[model samples]
Target: MSVSVRTRALTAADGTLSHRYMALRSLMKICVKRRSVVTFLALFTLSVVLINTIPLLPKETMRLPPRDLKGSTSKRLPAGTPSTLLDLPPPLNGHKNKLFSGSSAIPFKQPLSHSVKAPVTSQAAKTLNSSNSTRLCQQKCIRDGGGHASVAVGEAEMTQQTVREVSGEETAHERKPDSFWKRRSHSFAGKESIPRDRMRGEKSDLCQISVGKWNETTPESLPWLSAGDVRKMAFLSGGVVLSKARVPGHGQVLQVGLGAGEAEAEAEAVLDHRQHCQSGSCALIKRPSDWFEVLAFHLDRVLELNRSLPSVLRNFKSKLLPYRYISGNARPVVWWDPDIQHLAEVDNDQNSFSLSWPLYQKVLQSRCGARVSLNATPCVGVQHSEWGRLALFDFLLQVNDRLDRYCCGFRPDPSDICLENLLHVKCKSPNDLLLVHILVRRADPSRLVFIDNAGRPHHPHDNLNFRLVEGIDEFPERAVSILRSGCLESMLLRSLSADRELWESRGGAEGLRPIIRTIQQRGTILLQHIQNRILRLNKDL
Candidate 1:
């Protein structure tokens, strides 16, 4: 009986052990199944946290943004004008320019003739705008960059820009910033709001170039900075130059960075009776005008005078500007860079040029081909043609700003005052001199800079205007050659016609006709005048 009972108990114990082992094995399998999914979930959460938060924090030292974002700011300080305002469309996109190949030119991209129309709204402008700090630097948080989402958004913007180009419908409403909206809630404190649709000088036609992401793929050439880079350069002294600011009701003048001699020039000009005069008649003061700036750039390019500092017409409205130009108006802004700045005078003596006061008078008194005392003494780096290039342009434009501004010095003729001795450079201010509209070639200084050439215009017979020569005798070889070739008429006309939209916007064809006619008329008059002057000077000599 005992053996039978013990055997039964052992059997029961074995059965119980088998059941428990089976249950344990099943539990282990279940745990293994859940572990993989748990690990994946944890990894995903960590990744999401890392992506969104890491890039958003302000760094101890943020890397300098791409050139496109940190564009050179306008240094010209706030200056108010009369009701007359200048508006410019955005930088154009298109083919590389053939006009001025040697000097860097902002080649405009032309839209197709058969255009389609797109609806321009406040939102569109923000998405496609050029000057916003945020838009310029928002690349870090974007996913994969190659992802479908980014591609879709970019394609959409480009498509819209194309459509607008075809339609020729421009003018966009201004959208307030998110921070602005948050700050104001309802009202903009210390700011007067202007309606975007009614925003004067609003242009919808402006579109950005299709520059792709940097470093993601191999580049074809050195990356060209966006228009914003050039447009938004550092304005070291941007503000109402108290030294030159007008009375509250009189006007406002905002100067950006004041380079070496600009401050002294401004002070001198303010006090000196010269800046207030034009056409041999001096007024108490002359109201500042945008004509000299915007028009000067266009004219320089047409004439292929690459000596001028690069300038572009920009349009924006902010309290930073004067009241007259605060409503999305256009104004000409110069981009002066130290990197490209060259001295206005070189050490080479062979390139030395000499001009006596009498020759200066002859240029004013004579006409064309007068063969004034321009001795072709071979100077090393100075070419008569180069200096004459800017001189001829100044004459055509009636420039009267630069004269007697240089510290006298030219080899073999240090005692004699010559135009080639224009010593005050744009980058460095002279202790006793003023630097006016000038840009010297980094490679050579004898090359005259025609930048900011726009200044007080003089009468045709005003013996004091025209470049280099205070007097008009004979037109330089550069001028006569260019004029006789009949290139002026076509080049000038093409330049005007090419940017017909800007002309029309600023002034319709009827309004522009007079200016065009006047320019052409001046050319004819100039030729005749030069011919007469040349004959007189030759006989006198």
Candidate 2:
């Protein structure tokens, strides 16, 4: 029975073993069919284990002290060292840096006119001398409180280079030569030596001149002329046909008079016209746009009380005159004064008395007519009061050709005859600076006869020829009072209105107002300058 039970158990064990072997065989077949996928999974698992085992950062680097996000300082970057070495986390600094808040520390560019040397800061100086690259300097600046100091450093470097170039330290190849006008403009010192207003008024008519009908002739148009001068201008304009168009020595004036055919007519001309023009009954004609002469005459009568030539606006064509002199535009006509004494163009110095910059200054100091002294020399002929009047008048009209013939008072462009003719170069030696257009009459040597009354109406107020009044320690009290009256505009308007031609030529009162305003503003500046000068003199006394 035991043997039989053993056999059965063995049989059962064999059957169970055979069933397990069959199951293992079936599983092996299935694994063989998907062997590629199973191999890929095993390889992936091995790679992941290898990756997990390795370290990204060095042990010492990873063991850094934890930063205090709440409030604590970290190691600062060394001076002249790059801040980009370490990756910066979000700016955990509690306070926001105003400079870095989407704004540059300093403007990158500035106008050349207003540009000045950039002030060197200690930090910028250090950066300049540092051997590090510019990027390193920029990074170091950024780390210092995030002030955005990089821009300042860059600007300083650029400005220093520019200064070096301007100072002639740079090679000539690096710089181009400046123009004559540019050099003169820069030499002006921007601010006038005399005091001026800080805030200027509107510049609507600062350098503007009026244009009008050239043929407009009426009593209203010739307002600047007296009843007598008016008749002379009318006669010169149209009453009689002109003959003999000859050029005068001093100016572009054309001398015109009756032909031989009309010589009898000249003697029989209107008795009043003959009385108005006694000097051979001739007239000098100027260009149509030469309104400056007319303006000067009116200003002489109204402001300085100086004796200027009588000029009137008139327009009339004559076959005898050259076409260049006749633009069909109304031109200025002045009565010929044959008796007036003046130096001929042949003389080296055209003025009756020769004067230079240093000489003029010495004459002003001598106070010639005020106190008699044998040493007065050239100052003897000129009246002490007359100098003040001349200086005041020249300053108002900015007639630099007379006193400041070298254009030392203001910046002169190539358009100016003084600069164009290279006369300004003589200003380098003040002793050699000679005065021109200083006129006097044969009848009276005491007073000055202003012949070339063509004033520059468009001269800028800022660039006014103040050098005309440089040596004048005193100004005419009457002229000062007139400027101070505050009615200068009204007085000018009223006086200008008398000349119907000038009034209508300048677009009437509307066009005249702007020019009048510019003059008024200049008057205000002159008043201030006078007051300051008086105070200074009083202090010195």
Name the top lDDT candidate.
2
Ten contiguous residues with the weakest lDDT in model 1: 178-187
- 169: Cα error in model 2, Å: 64
Over 1-541, each residue of candidate 1 has an lDDT whose tens digit, in order, gives 9999999999999999999999999999999989988999999999999998887653121111122322132121122210111111212233111111111112132333322222223544533443342232222212112112222223233222211111111111122221100111111111112222222112111111112332222111211222332232222112222122232222433333222244544554444232222111110111235544545555654443445544434443333335655455555555433333433354321112333333433333332222233233222233334434555565565554453345221121244223345442321332444324444455565455555466433333323232233232222332342343222432333333333323544563345444544444344444444432321111010
Q: Can you write out model 2's per-residue Cα lDDT over 229-289, one digit (the tens) per residue?
A: 4555455445454444455354667766532336655665444443434555677778776
lDDT for 315 in candidate 2 is: 61
Residue 187 of model 2 has an lDDT of 14
lDDT for each of the candidates? 0.34, 0.51
Could you tell me how far off, in angstroms, the CA of residue 105 lies in candidate 1 after the best superposition?
A: 36
